[model samples]
Target: MVVIAVFKSSRPEGKSAMKWFGAAQQRGTVMALTALQVVICTVWLTTASPTPYKNSQYITSKIVYECAIGSVAGFSMLLGYIGLLAAVSFLLAFLARNLPDNFNEAKF
Candidate 1:
């Protein structure tokens, strides 16, 4: 969703703006990037720790040590990516504020 929003916000006005990258290309790019994001998260979470157990005690490892550290790191990285995308989107939108709205409803 953020990827799509960034692309839409950065799109310039005029017929020649995105002559080579039409709607199809935009959709493809978004889909590809979304898939890549999913893969990255999946890989990070799945392979985060060498083993789920911290010590020989199964109860302690499973109950108290349930991937606390790895999950935090993974989520922090995810949050960083989201924050970066948001910053880019905000910058693009601010720069394009003077341009005509792409959606007619936006003028209302």
Candidate 2:
């Protein structure tokens, strides 16, 4: 909404640059997150195993196994990714903390 509103109005000094910067930032963040998620999911799914069930029974043998999460490496990867995201978010927040609430894009 902010970007749309800014673009809809008459041109103003720095408005074009700020809006473009914000849009680029948003796109980059989304693409990075999406790529990370894809890599994580691919890694996790590739490492997954079929669900285990008790028995030597015929019924158990008939059960079809599906992908299930169970791997130390996958968990570690997820944790590392989460930590990285947290660290980045924290850094951005800290940097923006001093900015005023209104028109705070300057710091960003």
Candidate 3:
């Protein structure tokens, strides 16, 4: 997402802006980077020593006995966070492209 934000800032000279970020190799590169990030996070999570909090018998409220709820909630939160980042970055790119660079300059 940060890569897309930085890539969108420059104006294209001879080619379309899509070509700048959407190259055939770029898709693979982005996927690889994302996977690498996830793997690193997973490694950290797996290697970390758990604290003495025995409360983890219930990741969520003790009222819910189904463990699936906790996993589902976590998955949803992750997806929502990723979606929000993409949406906000795209919105910023849109505003950057359309808004006037300088408001002080007079047309009249």
Off by over 4 Å in 3: 1-23, 49-52, 55-92, 95-108
Q: Please, what's the RMSD in Å of model 2?
A: 9.4
- Candidate 2, which ten residues in sequence have the lowest lDDT sum? 1-10
Q: Between prediction 2 and prediction 3, which has the larger lDDT?
A: 2
Highest lDDT: which candidate? 2
Query: TM-score for all predictions?
Result: 0.55, 0.51, 0.33
> What lDDT does the true structure give each of the candidates?
0.63, 0.65, 0.54
**Runs in model 1 with CA error above 4 Å?**
1-17, 49-67, 71-73, 101-104
Q: Residue-wise lDDT of candidate 1 within 1-108, one digit each (tens)?
A: 333344554656433544546688879978986786787688777877334544546564454544445666777777787787789778876765654456325543
lDDT of 2: 0.65
lDDT of 3 by residue, 1-108 (tens): 334434455455533555555566678877875885586445544555223333445555554333232344445545665787689768867765654446336576
Clashing pairs in 2: none
lDDT at 105, model 1: 56
Residue 47 of model 1 has an lDDT of: 70
**Candidate 2 residues 48-75, lDDT tens each?**
7335644445565566544444776887
